[model samples]
Target: MPAGYSLHDFSFDLRQHMAPANVWVTSGWTSVVAAPGTVCGVGGCFAPPYAAPDSSLSVTLEVDGRELRDGVRAGIAGFGLGLLTSGGTWRPDRIERSGTFHQYDDGRLVSLGVHSRLTPVHGAGGYVLEITVENRADRDAEISIHPRLSAGQPGRLPLADWGWMAPRAGDLVAAASTSMTLRHDLLHSRVPAGGRTRFTLAVELGEAVEPGEAARPGATEPDPADRARQATDRWARRLATALDAFPRLETDIPGLAAYWHRSIASGLVCLWDNPGFVTTPFVATSGVDGGALCAYVWDTGGYAPHLLTLMLGETATDLLEAMLKADLTKHYAIAPDGTGLGVAYAYSGWSLVTLATAVASQRGLARGLVERLHDAVAALDARFPAVGELRDYGTQHNLLEMRGAGWEHVVASPNAERAAYLDALATLAEASGAVLPVDALRATAHRIRASIADELWDAEAKWFRSRYPDGHTELTYSVQAFDALRAGACTPQMAADLIARVRPGAFLGAYGVSSVSAEDERHYELGDTDWSGGGAYTGEAPQLALTLWERGEAELAWTVLSRLLWMGEHYPYFPQEHYSDRPAAPPVGRRANIIAGLAGAEAILLGLVGVRPRPDGGLVISPPPAPGNVALRGLRFRGRSIDVECTPHGFSVTVDGRRIAPEGGAVVVPAA
Candidate 1:
């Protein structure tokens, strides 16, 4: 079998690779695990309440009469096998015992390369592992490949017992607990003197109703090579579709272009569509290795808007629907066990609005879904006290309570977000032609907005401050104010003041925008990994950048975006947050944060590309007036795909392959 190409650079330095130790490839229901030293397995095989240990595959490789039980592990251990990259070399003999692992450059190598992929088939899915090896010495190399699954350990019951799998020819059958089966195929060939050879191991995991029922619907029994080709084609189409939706950056900077492509691909990987589980198709904030296997309402909400930019409307819908179906009263995070919702911060309203925006943009939300959403929002609204003369209820700090701001009692950020949610509900009701309390929602939103401008805005501080429940106001510069600004609660002058305060020495940091002004003594303080005192949260960076972009601070917006992307160069995964200080601490959470990826994607599509979806099934696009060339193609809006090209001279828009006159032909940057 020929080696399959990698969608992204899955190859990392050997030392850092074991930190997570597992590489996950998922086609919704089926999750394939590819670990460096150990064999691969299927994750989440058993249903909810039963923690099923993955069915592990162990491998043995024979080269030149030498039997290798674990080629990768042996190679890292410096047993005649060596790992080489362009910049650094790693051998067992020269292993360093101190500090960080030797960082290897990302490029080609003559020795070996391991690539893994998750591909969907008609009824089942295939996890393909392609290993390519080249003989640099002058000798013919004979290779033998062995792949088998060992019975899981006893005593752990449902999760530990690997069940019972009877191997027949090329297939493995499990009949004990759950009706599951997998077909495995190994393909390999000999390598001539100084020649290269590719080995492929394909495993097909699918559901079986009875003892010997035919393969599940859409499952196919194909050759390992054919399976790999199909999976490769599917992933290519997905990446192409996603890339067409945003501006293709033309830059001389290294890794910038790869970042754009990887960002979209990584975001899609984190979105799971498992039909086997209760929440069959929900987006996991972090993939399996990220340690966050469930969905958080706030994180999913943040992910929805960005997911829309990738033309993943169906996926975004599934996630929002799952959230609505879960216990809305305690809607905080969805447990991995699929049992009940976990309550933390009372910020479901914010997530609801994001879901509404994504649904409204699709222009095809079912009336039933809209009505259900309306009821949920109404229930959420009832939890808040009425919008009285002072609108104190609207100013409650319920939104940022999880971020260590609960002591503030009342805050403008949640009020602004509440106002935004009400506006979204009204818009969604009108768009779906549903008989919702649009008038009442609009009135409440208006009251909340009025209160934010009047009660939260401190004239002397020139910032939106929190008004204590005791009738006292606390003046603290916070990045949370950007949320209110995004909701349009601030006037023109007020917005300007906030923007000026976010300049480089204040809230802006090298990694991203800080949660609090640098001048604040508590800016560098850390609290429970939340955005309390201060931290550069990747999820919030794009929000602030987008706000600045909308306010015509194009240059500043791009600066903020550049900083966020800069972190991607250093961190292998999309970090959740970082310290505000220079040379910030290592990123928090797993390498992949769905919220951050989505937000970064949105910053490119909505902020820099200046494309906004209108409730009336139209698009409002206004690309920033920056001195760079960008061509945005394949942008889907309200069932119509549009292409946009922007240059220093002007810009052009084409709707569904036909050119249409834009409201504004070209954006001219004002002289500083």
Candidate 2:
């Protein structure tokens, strides 16, 4: 009865408000149909794949005063039935051979009878329905109905379009995203003697339609595109369900909001699947479910804090403590003099910086924890004293380890900058106005920054290079270079030069920057075994663009952001990783993918106008400086309802009807 309410939410056919149109197919497969019960003994139904047996079934329904639009079709794909994209072929797993439909209305009340079942593979949700017939006669009853879900655009490919697709031969993506919706109808069959027929279809329990609300009219058919978009709304409900699976986080509500808000803030950095993992916190794009089992992680130390710091401040402290306990024993088996070890192990140390900083921020220097953190920082400085790129740590347990090994360390390392960035942990040491060992960490960070500028910066190459034991630099521009810029350790010219070098090749692909520079031959290696291994290795392009923008490269950053989104629109769904070479690889799974994580988080939390808690107990409404025509309307922030209009002229914020002072340079309001 309300906007955005669905049968899954209110047990009613909210489709009643949709506009009338043609049959449609979403992404492909899922179908909806509409029909009148007056003569055809038919009503309406939403159908999905059935379970147990190999056939599809309609979840039956009956409505009163409901305009049953024609039948429609749709599809669902990508990570846990979320991340839906329009256009695809949906072949019937199987069709129901026999079924029944009936409708009866007693003034204000209505009843509908139907039976059907269908099954879909890899589909978790299932559908169910049962009805009894009293008549002893059988007849061929033709249900007058239209397939609202199978409709196409004014000029679009038909449902059978995929029949012509070449399997992975080339891009199987549609020419463009389709815009459509779905409507469904009742299924009919025979009347048997005192017998009841039971039917089942795959469906989420939350989306089941209520018996009484089934026939209430006003359901209209939309194109397939509209329907696919509708399916994505199901993700939040699914997220709620998935949350039920996890034990309630042991943290206060305010703390919990802070934690989620931190994650939400990180999401603003990029709109790709980099469910931030490793040391850097949420990568704005590359991260997933916290803890060790995250997807494609690198530098978890830098990635983890981005997720924990803003919220659950105490919990963040606990997380750091936990990592110290778990990782120290496994990843940091280094000797005191930092000698005789075959390789370098830094992920634990990198992450420890985030942990120590988080703890010091909350508890201050008086807590003995600061000493332990200082000790850890001291160890890191002692271990990788030279400040070159780090190597992959090693393999431990089931997941790939990040213990920084031998000469292998020079390749694909996230060292130096990560360590320097993590050294910001020292700032928390000043919490009590007491001098801390923080200065030691700051000095170490400064040393690494200076070393990078002196040795790693290749003036001829115009970017930072990976220094190797062979005394040759890997002449390539790296996002790791951007990390140094973000650390505020790089000089302005260095940052500008880094941006200049990144504009060429895969680093500036159709999406955003690639983790590996395109000019480097080793960037696209495919293998069953290697440190980088296979699967999704490249970072989402939007993330690199965001880093550039954050570093003040606005125009070039916008160019990359637009291209990455454009590439996203062409995929099966917003992939966790896109092929730097092929923009249309039927996106990989969504676990720990930063792109989806960042995009979804940004759309709701930041693009909608973000709220961050300031140390002084107020909120900061810093809207993202996203390129293109970015706007935030109906944004709700602390102390007032507000909206932000951003342009090249900078940003302006309005609260209620009054323009507030952004004069503070950042929008700060007292904490709620």
Candidate 3:
């Protein structure tokens, strides 16, 4: 371990030989490659953008006339350190390596510290290779410095002027479509005993134009080290601020604390701020530069509440606005061109209303913003068709139908979500002071609730069923029915029945609650990529867990939430979906997925801490009566910082460091 380094740091290590070590600049333009047989570039060296090329960037080092090419070990460190080893059979137990990824506030700059040390032997000495790659806002340049280094070309370089010069030679302009390869014999430097050297490689895509040029004015390029330090400090401040603003939960469960801390940090990183695109500044579904770069409406909405807790109201607002801007009222996915695509799923609109209400209720949205959202909600609600006498809306498929509906039958889950959305609309209307048909909305919500109890509830099966247009029903067990619990559509007995089915070997699995019953034959056959049959879509798990907690099933809710947190430990960050059987395996879809990350982080505050925001702008701190004593601190509400400490005796609260007596001996405070 090194200074400013901890195991909790999000990192990926290259355990095998010649494994690909890729690093992406924060600008999302350049990828620094250190893998064997690859060409390392700063700017357009790789693809135009997105990720590094398939070919590896090659580097050969020479020390004291001895060429160190084979059996050499190298690693690319980002946000943390990971050392790489040569593909040959060579093992040196005396060498220690570490590194850290640093991101600057400019959104176009990032750096990493690649450090190594050789243990003292009878005649052994110290050696250091300091490698730093910085994306310059100025002209394009690729600078690589090693101890008398000779570079080899393992693959064909794209047409670009190429040449070998002194390690400290000045910048040279190259012609387009020019290519050159430097031999290892062109090195003449060496490292003396107890000596250290710094290597710098920079590649700038001078041709890359700044998107929305007006958005970035007077951008100044700083030294890599200074930028790195500034990035480190900024991240530190962010984490500290998050801890101070959100409630903290410490439990006796193993690995829970570390997961809590990492989720908060990782959630912030998922926010992308690139301009020129509709999804710019929107939260990405995954950290991957490839297919997972786009944002999903359902996923963004799932994570918005947790973002509010962290005082990231702007990010939540941006995401919702992006979706509406793409016309989510009629589309399932928002295209990069700001156009909506695919038929609007029922859950997507429901998510919009839900997230809108949360943001407005938390005062995260301005009155004008709320007005826009109210209009979007009204538009989305108008798209739903009246399918039955109940006037309850339906979807072609539920959230589980990621690809498409296997059966075009009316589903209970979407109707339940619609009920919740109607409630949210009423709340948002009241909060935003916007003119809305509140009485009609409430009456419609009541009809939907009653219809859920009469038409969807399977009294004999003791669960909700997906009814078809022909009056037939699919009696398969689905965790989605729990949405009714959150929508206030379930009866006391129905809620008890749903709670009982959430146990392990049924709907619950090792990782989290399964989408379908584990005992179902179709559970194992669901499509691996999206929500299909039985696997747990990490984004939806927490909603059910939160509902369970609110419905007085705190123990069962904790069981689901803790399992999801535990599973999140395996990924560098939280992922989109995890298979029920392969709980510890890497996610089947995107890595560093934001939806699940946001949802999981929110579970800590909404489920464990019980920090629910009221429509009247007041705060409520009513943690469940679980066995463990809980302490929630730094909850921001009505411009005041609140803290709550719970014990067997009762809970004590402090607002802005002043002790406040609870109303009726419970932690309840009026709106500031």
RMSD (CA, Å), each prediction: 8.5, 15.8, 11.5
| Winner by lDDT between candidate 3 and candidate 1 | 1
Residue range 13-59, candidate 2, lDDT tens digits: 11221111211111112222212111111111212111111122222
Candidates in order, TM-scores: namely 0.75, 0.51, 0.74
Give me the candidate number with maximum TM-score: 1
lDDT of each: 0.54, 0.34, 0.50
Candidate 3, residues 1-672: lDDT per residue as tens digits? 012222234343333221133222222222122333222211112211212223223334332222333222353432222222322111111122343233342344333233432111110010111242332223232333343322211122221111111111122333342222221221233333333344532222222234433112235533333433343443445444434455555566566665665465446555443443454444545443333445566765655454543445445566677777866556665543345655656667677777676766565456566667667766776676567633334543434553443223555666777777777777676777767777887788888888879887889889777665567666766666777677788889988888888877887777666776766554334564334545666666777778877787777888877776655344444555666545643322334244456676677676666777776677777777654676666666657877766654566778899987766635667766
Model 2 vs. true fold: TM: 0.51
Task: Output the number of the lDDT-best candidate.
Answer: 1
Residue 629 displacement (Å), model 1: 0.9
Q: Considering lDDT, which of the candidate structures 1 and 2 is the better prediction for this target? A: 1
All candidates in order of lDDT, best leading? 1, 3, 2
Residue 551, candidate 3: alpha-carbon lDDT: 81
